[model samples]
Target: MKRDYDIIVAGGGLAGLIVASSAAYYSNQSMKILVIDRNAIPQQGKKTVSGWVCGDAVGKNTVDYMADRIKISWGYPEIEHPVKGVIAYSPDHETGISFDGEGYILNRQLLPQRQLRDATKAGIEIKERVALRSLMVEGNSVIGVEGDDLDDKTAFKKTAQLVVDCTGVTSVLRTNLPIKSFIQRRIDRDDLEATGRYIYNFELAHEDKTYFDSDYCIIHLDQKLAPGGYGWVFPKGENKVNIGLGVQQKAFDTRNRVMGVHPDLKTLIDEYVEVNPVIKSPRLADGAGDEGNAWGTWQVSVRRQNDCLVANGYMLVGDSAWMPKPLDAGGIGPAIIAATIAGKDAVEALQAGDTSEKGLWKYNKHFINDYGYKTAGLEVFRRMLQGLTNEQINYGMKHFLSKMDIDKITKGEHPEFSTVDRLGMIIRGAMNKKLAEDLKYCATINKVLVDHYHNFPETPEEFSEWHKTLTGHLEEAFALYK
Candidate 1:
């Protein structure tokens, strides 16, 4: 069947769903949106995503302004992470930080579905079991898409006036994108982490028992404990939890997918469940990480480096676009900001009635102004931090950043944590001598991010200059490695 729509949104993930739902209200009402997804949501689907990073607030705001209406199929927001920020700890439980109430651990399935439902009701169409195999391009521009059924051999062809590459990760519309080629690229594989998890309905053996709050997420960061990565316990209210963890990617060795990775997550999970004595787990961790060594594997995530993602007609968003933050590669916060720009700019271009490459270039400029280029430098910093020793980490965490503490940085207060400001703090604190230099170096790296962020281009022409500045500082920073 030949299907024609104004927009064909590939991969019905949060980013895709958001761009569709959010733009529905402000965009030209004559436009039609088609959303595609693989897995079938349960009878109950929230319009927003609810996880540790995503939540109801982000969902509601999108729905209120962008979605504009509530319906099972048309307009809505996605994700719902209800928990407060994080309470972190190490293997020995020696070092810990209670982030104090920060943000919610969203109900992942709830919000996106809610938004999808809203989109459908708002006149957006959904194509389930449809996976985009490639993009249909004519000369320099994208024309439409060709898709097929995920569970069947049905071939589907769809055409759109403007093709939106909402296909996360496997973006089909990237070839038509305008990617830059003249940058020095470096990838760190030793630092890669592969993670997997499962969602289960926990049933208590003892009746009349109640779970507390139903909105807290527990994170484990102890090195030797989880090693290479960390574990997360996310609560989705009403006694449901999304329990998972990420392990060092190198440990998994995906080349020969049969063997398991280290710290067998299944064992860790089983031990934790029994250790609790009260909570029961109906699912376990098993994936490329475990080689099917555990019970039911709920989810699996892989993180690697992408050299360059920018292209002429397409822009990457969410995971498919590799837009995770360097700190933890978390997407919820960053995607909200990026997606807001991508959606708004696309809508604006449509309103102007011009979908040219030049019109779409604003998305790149806007992102670079915000995080595109900063992530480049931060990516370098992630490499440097991963190679350094624990002493180096603890020292830098305590002293160098001591003056530029996150609490203060987030509050818009200039960091007072210079080496001079930290002399007393550093001399008496952690770093002995060998690690001090790295801390000093990290301080300089921090300066690079600050400078780069402050000096990020105000326009697209300046983007090339911004990359030059970032890569130049990154070269100096990379020299400090090893």
Candidate 2:
């Protein structure tokens, strides 16, 4: 069987482009790559809305490294209206905690199109409006893909030495792989974050306008409103903002099934927007103005679980590999890091003429070490938060925790409570026993999971034992909530 290219990347999303472009740009121009996408290139205003917030220097470095390789001539956009920090409100909308930090709001559509232009310039072949049908597999290895042109319905078979699935969460190629393969057969609903966003632009007379700090983002936490998740407002600039709510499907479905009050997410958001103090006299943005409508609704797997990310002649990147942060639902940074690693490894494997599961295993090793370990602990924390009631959360926000504590936790640094601090927390807990117990339990589980991830196996041979240990820890952790 003649191969059509050195690599065939199915799906031309951000991660896919990064994989193709990185390989072409960094592999000394030696590899032939093809990127097939179901949709045509999105126009400037028609693309999806997204934003990135860098938590540390590593994130910024990853972005810069990839940009250099891709030869992007444009200067990285400045952090427009830099956020001073995030102010989080309790479910009661009374208690609030503010954390000081720095982050940027991005023009989502512009970022990927920029990458695509660089990819094309790097000589990676891109075919738009081509939908991936399935993987071309032989025994345990993926060999290529079967796809068709969306407009003409013209079918095509393309073979390659390696096939990378950069397809988003609903990956047909990855899902179709044999159950025995390393990938998980399905994403559990409990692990998924279902989100709905509405972006609005408003013009208000000076006296009529309500004030919101454009320098800070806001998060509203109310399980009654979002169930297992939270709502957020991120400003792109003055008078323009992204507002949305996210709920874990498992919790959302369970509540609806038991209570029989199926709250539509979009309707809830609309109602919130109407009464929200800061959003006075709002109108929908550009194309969304006619119906007073929302920009979009989407889902992503937010929990980190143990799954094989690589198989013979195949690899997964971005959402296909479930690389998003469990706590924040941030995927841009992880996607870039994963794509860069996968691209370099894929090119090396091709050069060595060994695309076996064992040969491509380094990509998985690097990811688990660099990114996966951190997210595993966050997933545990996310689950613990899901188990808490609104009153419990309000109590914590009001009495024990502060913004600096949250900043420490976000940076993977556990907050250190001094004896005096512990005494204060204990005194606060005495006033509310159940809240105290829940806080203690959450702290214990957080330590347990964080410790476990820090000990992740270094090689494939040790993965099974380590994974077994992880499963046992997770089961025990979840059992505590029950």
Candidate 3:
């Protein structure tokens, strides 16, 4: 079958737009690309409240490149709110720790829309209200995609030399890929972080006294409220804040059953807001406080980065590749990095006249080396934290874990602990033996995993053996909690 385009990118989210834009940028506008999205492109103010906290050099560079192309100033009111620090609260809400850092509470939709506009200007075609149903496969290789035009309810088939799935966590195309493929069949529910969030304009009881400092974001480690996850308050601006809670699916289900209520994210957020001293009687930004303007609820995969991001004639980017950072469910950084590489690889593969899995193997190799290695450590850290009770976390945060350590981990780097630092931490952990053992075990497991990822197979031929070792390490890391 003759391909309709050189590349058909599924889902016009941040990742897809980046792929299209970067492909055009690197290929010098030579590649023909099409981006299909189920919903209309988001406009300013018609977006959910979310933040992208990235302090890494790669993330900043990607954003700068995109900003230059999109012609938008990349800070405050226009793109995102500059954040200076974060405050973490214990489960009891009695004790808190403040950490200095740098990030942004992004205007999630604005950045993507800007990128979409740039892609269009670069000659990439985009279709809105087009829902991808499945891939069109020929002998184990993806040839194209079949989707529905929701506006007209018409089915259409568009063939391409390469198909890239940038669809979010519920990626229809990724799941339908051949079972023999290296890509994961599905994301485990335990690995999913189910979240509900609301963006609200604070209605302070006293104008003189504000609830929270706008300069710093807030994280609530109250497992009783979030249950195996955390709650967050990210400043959208001086007046507006995005408040949400996330929990692992199993814990959420258990909490619902025990509470004898549906226990949806909305219910959890409402309960937290009503009783919390800082945010009582908040008003929705949309002026629907009484009726409650729910931004949305969704699930994000926080698993270790997929070992296989490429298959025959296809690649998975962003959430489709399970690239969200486990520490805080941050994906934009990794997604941008992956998409940029995928775009470059796609261009190179087309030029080389070999769009097979092996042709695109560099995408997988580079991604693992650039981003996946560090994420392995964070995933281990997340698993370790999941095993701890609220009291233990509070104690550890207060005594041992420093702001610098968290900053390094979040930026996709392993925490550096010198002998003096380790000794100090060990002395502190002596107060809590279980916490000490768990922390030491997690550190060892994290080192092993990070080292393994650094040594990821250079070619697909070595994947099977490398993956076996990888799985064994993951099993051992998970067992630390068990």
Q: State the lDDT of candidate 3 residue by residue for 87-170, as single tens digits.
A: 777776666766565666665645666667678889999988776888988897889999889889999789999999988777
Arranged by TM-score with the best first, the candidates are 3, 2, 1
Cα lDDT tens digits for candidate 1, 367-444: 656555456545555555455444544444544554235554333223334564446443654444545555455656
lDDT of candidate model 3 versus the reference: 0.73
Give the poorly placed runs of model 3, Cα more than 4 Å off.
42-62, 65-78, 92-99, 206-211, 253-262, 287-294, 416-431
lDDT of 2 by residue, 352-455 (tens): 88988778878877776666666765776678678777877887677767455667655544433222246454555443555555556556666776677666
Give the clashing residue pairs of candidate 2, or none: none
Look at candidate 3 and give me any clashing residue pairs: none
The better-scoring model by lDDT among 1 and 2 is: 2
Tell me the deviation in Å of residue 162 in model 3: 0.8
What are the lDDT figures for the candidates, one per model?
A: 0.51, 0.69, 0.73
Measured against the true structure, the TM-scores of the candidates, in listed sequence, are: 0.73, 0.86, 0.88
Considering lDDT, where higher is better, how would the candidates rank from best to worst? 3, 2, 1
